[model samples]
Target: MLLWRFVGRTNVILSNGVNWQRHSRVVKSALNRNVPIEKFASLTKRLFSVMGDGGRLLTFSTTLTEASRFILCLLSGTTALGHDFNTIVDNHSPFVAKYNEVMDSIASPLFLVFPKLETWFPRKHVIRKIDDLVNDFGKLLEDKKQRPGNDMLTYMLEEPEMTDEEFRDNMVVFFIAGHDTTAGAMSSFVYYLSKHPEAQVRARKEVVAALGKDEPNIENLRHMPFLQACIRESLRINTPIVSCLSLMVILSPILRAIIPDLCSNGKSYHIPAKASVIMNICAIHYNETYWPNPYKFDPTRFMNQGDGEEARIDASLWLPFALGPRQCPARNFAMYELRTLASMLLQQWEWNLPADSPHHDSIKNGFSPFALSLPKDMDIIFRRVEQ
Candidate 1:
């Protein structure tokens, strides 16, 4: 159930700083390629269908997860391996299902503390599932070898340093990295908007006014600053990636005893050399000094920048993707995806959480320490706007 089981140490995410930079360059180049806009539009339309016929009430997270997974699967497949998972049957798609199963199993407390223990007792199933997924990647790699195309797989194959194992590892990394995080972020946005109906109305107004009859292409999306603000606020309030990255946080007694100087700074600070520390993204994002009424969902805090109307805000406090050289490399792509999806959702239909739904008031109470802090549930009604 561990990430290492799925992606070995050779992958970019688990590699050292120098190796990560080298591998990241290739991966980033592939991601930076022009995205398939039309395909995304078609996928969103399909998502609408998956949501409901017209006015049916459904679980919002369920619907969003499906749509998000579908889009990611399609995009990742085509861009990474030159394959198209769009044609696959819904709910029965093996690739998507297998990935979800692995994700769910890995999020368990048992798996987190005792990753190697997955081979014993009931946990062995998780190992088998991951092996199956890796085998699937192997098959895909074989097919790509037979018919190489202009894709990430092709780019990776061209790199003499990349092993077949590493290629398989990167494929899974891309899938996991992009899929649930985006979906969770979108869900959090909608959840907040649902709780704040006035904000939702204002956001919809901004989107409609900015892009009247035009499709939500990248250019038009930029004009809707309110929508962007809402996205950022949602990211700040409920960060999907809570912990930046895994850290060892080592404080060995032997080392401390041997060298008192290494344990503490000359003043008061103390830390063993090479000890790891994880940055709590959610805490920093919610700190009072950085954000007033940190618990409230307010998008206007990000608006009217450089104008005399509001005080200049500090940008360092915001780190939804973490900071430094290893910051989330796909930040731009993630924002683009959120904007496009938000535009389409607001423009096409009116949505709101049902009064009886558990998540009507807030999703804050349901936060769990998973890969992403997803809401327990959100049931919403999506009604088509009469043309």
Candidate 2:
């Protein structure tokens, strides 16, 4: 009920069967084709501007999080909705505020603990806000109908019988899953880089060699293997989404029939049918068997020594975006965004943790009601690189 109120019943994240297939097909098609490199570059410049022309210390966590959120929102808007919320420049964007409010209400401890309380003591205001947000998306859909473009909404419009409800619901899901997770990822990357200066230097050197004072293009981004490794390592260490949502269940009736009592792999414990299983991503990532010295922040693990190629990562072990058919549709898109932003930041500034930083010893996680890994009190001193 809580999820339905926010993302509706027809979103890709929560929906099942035909609804899931339809949503995933359309969304994956849209995200896969559209990289939006230029958009990422432009928004990155805006972010740099906001960060100031600097050889000074900054509370990077706050600014980076805000910039990442706005950049991702804009990206999602342009690619998904064919609309510009102008959230990057306009900090007080009503739609962004309302969306945040809805998220906050959803993450409320009281409601999370006892969701049934929402039925007893209704959060009418939050529900109304969600409705308004959905209506706003509806307006975007109507606008897109008249002024169609090469975007997700336009593509969905071309579909035989794609409903407005489906469109709006998925848009809400994109807004929810798309931006926050990516922002959290960016934060984790920065946190790791701040702690590991040697890795940061290596990544920056690669970024400079690949993209010398030019914006990151797909061709250039491909050459920066070390930077990509750094991103991968950061994701492994502190994955943005900690665990797959408990709601996402493995409803394999055949498996249930075959192994009626208990199901077990050679390694892990047994699981009964209809069991509520949450794939603990952090545990898998930090497993000593797969990743030797798992706690160390080492990008070299993802690199091939002799060949200038990436090491073959076991997909089963390192699944920050989850695995298999239900993997995040925006995985490639998110990586592109990260690579773009991280490349730009690498080129523009050299950053290290402040001497008095709370995260000097280790990265500290911020409080979040959602299952997101967020860095807190991360102060990095950034020196502007002379062009």
Candidate 3:
């Protein structure tokens, strides 16, 4: 309830265009200019080089997790930390510790609901540790202020409308949301690629054709159809934000916050006045109403245009990143990382699993009853494609 008052519904931008203008500008400028992709290419290259080694690898493996941690730390540095993307990330021990700790433990939120029993339980440490790590971030931000020029944090601090408390909340939102969702969703992308060989092959062909021996840039990235389809597929199958709503929020001082997706097309979803309501992602995503053969893992479905069957699955059914005003400000940021990582993998390596391994579709608390969908413990072997 408290959080909702601050950020509103995740879909507010979609519904109230006029009111959303400033927030949109702030987010766009923050992501595009402040955290421009150029700063992080070195890290991408480093990761790509590792992919070229043809060594066996797996998602969330200690080594892979460490590499992922560095990339994510770099990502946060540019956006939330607002430091030299390279330097800040390497030196930020607290961030590395926080992120590494977050990854190592995935007890879920039961601890929050059961604090008393947490001590006697296994997951309690995760909560206590995460709280400590958040403090570590607070210190990092404080240290940045006395140092020098303003970065992302500095930019927010300059906002005349934002209070110190609001700024801190946004920071917490950044660290928690930024670290977990991006890495987790991308992990899903990797695991899906490993499990779905046909899609992987087709996706590589598209990457090679679109970027074709050229380094990935924002301009060229727009043309990669297969790569985009793979990303869309990964996001669709594993939505990062399971559900969202602003039903209880008011519009004016008189009426509460306006409901998003209010009477879309002709259908109206009843939103109780002054009550928290949610939009079920999986329900809408996998609904046969929107997607034909919804259960199938087919990226081509997104590419299909001529056939009406494929047309149904078009864009409507996919909601990996929730839509509207409060949607992820870092959608493109996350996508760039996913696409770059994926293209490099497909272009340079062929991934496989142990013959005895079973294809596990991941089991994090997701959609209907829990947190976002995630895939973990996925192991794969890579054979380098010789130049």
Report the C-alpha displacement of residue 32, candidate 1, in angstroms: 1.9
Candidate 1 lDDT, 113-213, residue by residue in tens: 87566666556677789889889988988898888887767767777767788788887777776666777787888778878879888888877887785
Candidate 1: residue 362 lDDT (0-100): 64
**lDDT for position 114 in model 3:** 62
**Candidate 1: where are CA atoms >4 Å away?**
51-67, 78-81, 87-89, 114-116, 119-123, 147-161, 247-268, 305-313, 364-370
lDDT of 2 by residue, 327-360 (tens): 9888887899889989999998877776788777
| Stretches > 4 Å off in candidate 2 | 53-62, 247-270
Per-candidate clash tally? 0, 0, 8
lDDT (Cα, 0-100) at 215 in candidate 2: 96
Model 3, 278-351: lDDT tens per residue? 67888777776666777666677667656412234444457676666566777777777777667766766666
The candidate, 1 or 3, that scores higher on TM-score is 1
State how far residue 244 of model 2 sits from its true place (Å): 1.2
lDDT: the better of candidates 1 and 2: 2
Clashes of 3: 8
lDDT of each: 0.71, 0.79, 0.58
For candidate 1, the lDDT comes to 0.71
What ranking of all candidate models by TM-score puts the best one first? 2, 1, 3
lDDT sort, best first: 2, 1, 3
